[model samples]
Target chain A: MSKSLSYSSITKKIVLSLAGLFLISFLVVHLLINMLILFDDNRELFNAAAHFMATNPLIQVFQYVLFFGFILHIVLGLIIQIQNWLARPVRYNRKGYSELSYFSKFMIHTGAIIFIFLIIHFANFFVIAKFGHIDPITYDSGNTYEDLGLLIIKLFEDGIYVIFYVISILLLGFHLDHGFQSAFQSLGINHSRYTPFIKTFGTLFSAVITLGFISIPLVIYFF
Target chain B: MDLTLKIWRQPSTDEKGKFVDYQVQDISADASFLEMLDVLNEQLVVNDEDPVAFDHDCREGICGACSLYINGRPHGPDKGITTCQMHMRRFKDGETIVIEPWRAKPFPVIKDLMVDRTAFDEIIRAGGYISVGTGGMPDANAIPIPKRDADIAMDAASCIGCGACVAACKNASAMLFVAAKVSQFAMLPQGKVEARERVQNMVSKMDELGFGNCSNTYACEAECPKEISVSHIARMNREFFSSKLISEKEK
Candidate 1:
């Protein structure tokens, strides 16, 4: 029993929605920067964007915010999942599972898988680029920075890792399928007219973003 | 119509229960669902066996008393109807039916297929009422409510306190039930005066009673006998927000 559980859970819903929406925006930004990999002769373009993201003062602050968003979303999701489990102490004898959509039924499952993927991804990329060893590259005259672009290309070149990335990205789609529309609904921004649009766009957004992320690994592996 | 029934039976609240299979024969296609249950109960009584216990009062979909999860949907397969209103014709002649009680921590089984839904009563007591003055009946048009508001209020007021929404919800959330009560009053001027405290009190009590928060799954509304819209939940969210906002401003 958490102390905060006594108050109205509306606060938790609002916070979860806000944090989730923030992370959603972060995904778009991340995809835009990561998309630069598809360009020709663009190690500089992608690396510079990555360097700016890592070192820019505003982005530096936002990096911490992004980390906080991840922590808050995961914690809130776990708490809500546990609360739901506790709420239904008994399971129905038959035919209950067919009632909920696959995405709705496995939200916690997808979220947990995404969390595990995030841990591995951050440790492999973010931590190394931040503190651990990465070979530095020098430009025209003076500037030298970690070659995160090269590290990413190298990581994605491995077929096993690429397969894992593809599967994880699809799992992220499952998470986003329910989460995007659900966030708006939780925050009380729903309407009869716009709700359908929101659901459609959320599905579209999740699918495109998933394919975009998966494209990076596939291109690096096969192309 | 012949049917195979898989029914849950529990002797008491603490005892473990299991699904017992029974074959019912020569059932009329037009018989109501509860009437079919009556036919089965009659057989049990004839054989000198204990009859299955279930709760029903009005038996006309008005009373929330009839609570049964039929074939994974609350109140049976048919939509916009309670257990009492569901008919045997909804199923195929040889179809097998699975029946169970509403399984949630707040709702415990008092007997086979009958759960103690006093949790809903507790929520209503929290703040689902307006304090009114004692007086003789006044003119109905005195308040001069707008047609739109009155219709919405009526729609919300139709909630029969059936735990179907709770039983149908994947999280076993009572959002539909509480939101209906909250909205029933939030729309009418009579309920507006206590809106702030009403939303706050009722939601807290719902949580304290172990009802899960709304995941917006919509299963509750899908299986609801009254067909109460999930929009009430969004409205309740707004009410809760304003409640917090106004009370904070007063401080």
Candidate 2:
């Protein structure tokens, strides 16, 4: 940290950005796993994969790292937000102001919505899969495992949960759409020639993530 | 061209302001925006009504004194161009344009479109200068700054302190202004000696002056007539952090 730097603002941003990128990487891994559900003719393969993720020691360690990252990311984001609010301490009452883009102005609002979505997601998937009593399933080899497929079906069967999943995925997509390229710019990766490409890549990635996640619920609900 | 102008008229900083309307007829489209204002003021003087008071010195746009929020933009709709350089042709005939002073708390209205931008002067006094002793001008080649660094430093130095950055900022931050000054000197060999103190003092002063914090919206860069990069803000952060760390270690 530079002595002259206002760490409260800049460091918070750096931390949030790096952690955000880490979480995005985690999301890619997660999306890949969930997409495996689409591949399995039966629910057995998906359940086995879920079982391995839950039981593998190395995977457990990775989960802990992810948990820490989430905590740090959220804490830093909150601190920065509070400090920014404190710094302003007043509001303008002008009727007509201009030059602000719609997306630029609503970052915090979108961020808060995403935060709520994460909490709901964790409760539905992580907590239930890890600690909650799941229905039993017997494999062809006579080994019994927790039925993650049934849990997913139950969660998506409800019309409200389906709506929630779609809304959350959309908000996540919106957040990632802005956050992906913004992180690169903040880290000083700006080369005018490559920025447009990066932005395009970010948009495509966010769209894919959103479409992939939303597909799971949509498939379960309709099928 | 004929135009209807709704100009802000505040008797003083303490008084409530109101928009006074004026119609100007047969103005040249090629006339600069300030020249159009000048013609309006000239007519006002002849009519014995108080002329609209605005600040301008170098009509060439170098002085950073002409600050106007034309139709809600800091320096008007044109990108990388100051108000003095903007011409009347940018507007259609019979258009009603609203002109207001820079609306930041730190930059209080002095009169019509003129503002007391002494906050900038104060931030400079807080340490925007190299503290080297008076001596004969050294040869430019003696410093031997890397070409890349020199170019970056010159880019930062191009900030004209027009208060456009502050006005464009949603939070009305002076970070872009202060960062430009800090980064310009911090980059050069001549400025390296006092880099620590320069950034520290200037930033602290900026905070002290009630300037809002940057939220990374990039509005300042968008509306800046000089187009100073937001990268300078990052450099300012880097300098301030490292300097504070070094001083802490010494302590």
Candidate 3:
């Protein structure tokens, strides 16, 4: 073998796809757990869910893995984009048209916005809940939980923040729209029998995850 | 019909290039894109000026020798056709056509609208072939390949190694071209003996040559004169992974 196949572009893509899929799975769990906020009128269910997520031993370990996945995906993505830019040093002066999908061309753009959103998200909720301060509430039965539900609702009360949150989530949807099926493609999982279905499923997944996350803030602020 | 041609004018590989405007009048709409260029060159030569440089052969489009980025497209504003197959009728009178060479790090512009695609030949040399033993001709029916697999292989075999896929790709990735070459062999039983090694070697060469990674944009498929599908890329990915796994196990 003249070269190590492990470091080839295909292998790099495979690693990227695996990490992206892992992050996607984490998104589902995060969205479902956050959905509890919508139905928790008494403010107990959402706080309980947050407490369980913070306290669960298995989840604690998985959270670290999830963090690693995000770092790997973001770093690898930037590296690929930079390499791609270098590949074509001179660009065409006249822009052309094809049947190419618009979202496919703008993944790096969408990903950058999502990265900024993540920083804000971590500072507003994760940092405060994890290391900073949040008032703890105690039930009559002697169970005490952080008042995360109130914190989230209070954050959503700001119209500007809510708008920014909604826009970022929408861009996340744009990212996922291409990424959901793209991950499978990178893994070489394409098939004539399953590809159409996977494409449809990817679009639906993007919409649901985007709307699901967006609904939380909108609902909290409105009613 | 009259047209304004803004063609790249580079004297040599190392020199800077720019689009130089030329005019051609009373051109037939039925003239092929290359023929229009031929007319422009003729006028330039008659005026004791340097003719515009480009690549063309087998004017029928099967040779994969002609390449041009015309009017912001790899092969003019046509679908499933090479630049040689593109007709002037596709453009209206007085249209401005921008023609440039394929731009990629591995494919440097040798001159105006002529890029050195020797990198592709280098990749082919790496492992784009299967070894065969010299012996008496075997019966055609000796190997029974599934009809579907054979058809797909035939589809993949149609790729002419043109760099349009690279020219059309946003990342300048050669995944489609490499995938088509890999699939043409991977689908046939006769080539299966070296399938694992072939994919690994070709991909390694491609990466070494500085081609970008596939972003799954499908622009390559859309612009391929052969219309090679991106599914072949998936198969190449599968082959690369399995090769790694099998090699690891053997060690």
Candidate 4:
């Protein structure tokens, strides 16, 4: 009923795919910065990266863009799904087996899990870092910053949170399994000569992201 | 083959429908699925009962008229074939086959196994054709179409406008149908002239009719009688986006 609903579904899909791809790029940056924690046992390097992310003017602006991207992706995805459900008012008694990809069929379910994970992540880390009080550590030269690295380490040390985080990351992998190349397909970037490669890379990318993020919590908990 | 059958029976579009059980004896395996249904109808007529109503035309598969969700799949279990072309041999003796009409908001069932597919005609009327001035016939080779492009265009053109894609889609999206139409035109020089307007107009009409968005399940492609590629869908997306970008309506 909204003005946006008047736009063609293809237009909505274009917007959704573009927003999703932006968020995918953001995840790459976030994971790389978060990966700093594992390499440096002292936590100095991780804290410095976190400090730069919080204080840098460019990244500060990008933070708002990232938030907007996440909101747009969530809203449009739900809108599309709702419209789709409405399209089929009557349900079939049984569905025949086809070669439909399992992950593609369940994107919304996987996305819902990922969204819940994000909410918990934001509440525990983002809210505390931005709005709530977190104890700060000062360098020898008096450059003071929030000890986000230590906060992360402490949080991951909790067995339950670590387990939840790993499971959530795994679901994120499922979401990405369809989402990565689907973004390209929606954008009309599919090509017979290159689609196979893009699909292969997408699967590899999903695996890497899943393993990389899962390694963070697992390592923090066990080692 | 002796078989048990479960067929949907609806008195009218406004009336509630239900699955009605039927039995057929000694049907020939060589008979087409529609022919088997004809046998059942003959028995119904002999018993003074209402015959099962369904849609079929040019029972040889070229006509996209036949539509029935057999067991669960559109156009029955065999891949890349419509209901009219489906033979009874695909089912084992004594198997119970379930048949239902296509279910979608735009495609309402008029009666048992016969949904009004006029929605498709509506989409076609939107922008499915190219304008050609009345004159002498143009030479076939005048356009100088590349072989690869010609092949792909022919592939796109083969779409029978069957609603199987809609029935197969979880979302009941008509993207594959619209995409096939748009792609067929967009690939050729004659079609290229109106490609921008064609995609935009067709997509707008599709949305107005309340078809769902494509979720990329590829079920539509797998179930398509013509085996239409989803890549045409991607092409339609690209066409729609590029057209909207520079659309005069935006001004």
Assess candidate 3 and give its TM-score to the true structure.
Answer: 0.97
Model 4, A134: alpha-carbon shift in Å? 2.0
Q: What tens-digit string does per-residue lDDT give for candidate 3 at A1-223?
A: 2233337899888889999999989999899889988885757788889999999999899889999999989988887888799899988887656636568788899999999999999999899989998999986657789989989888899999999999999999989988888889999999988988998899999999999999999988888
Give one digit per residue, the lDDT tens place, for model 4 in A39-140.
977677788889899889999999999999999999899999999999998888777567466788778898898899899999999999889887888877
lDDT of 4: 0.90
Model 4 TM = 0.96
Q: What is candidate 2's local distance difference test score?
A: 0.80
Model 1 agreement with the true structure over B1-251: per-residue lDDT tens digits: 99999999899999988889999999998899999999999999999988889889998889788989988888988789999988888999999999999989999999999999999999999999999998999888889899999998999999999899899888889999999999999999999999999999999999889988788788988888998988898899889987887674564
Q: What share of the true interface contacts does candidate 4 keep?
A: 0.81
lDDT of 3 by residue, B185-239 (tens): 9999988998988999999999889999899988899999999999999999999
DockQ of each: 0.64, 0.22, 0.76, 0.76
The DockQ of predicted model 4 stands at 0.76
lDDT of 2 by residue, A1-223 (tens): 3443355444455667789899999999888888777776567778888889999999999998898988887777666555455444323323224433335455677788888988988888888887889988897878787888877878889999899889878888887887787776555456657877988898899999999999998988888
* B136-230: candidate 2 lDDT, tens digit per residue: 98776876788899899999999999999888777678888998999899898778888888887887787667676666677888888888987
Which residue ranges in model 3 land beyond 4 Å of their true spot? A1-6, A140-142, B248-251
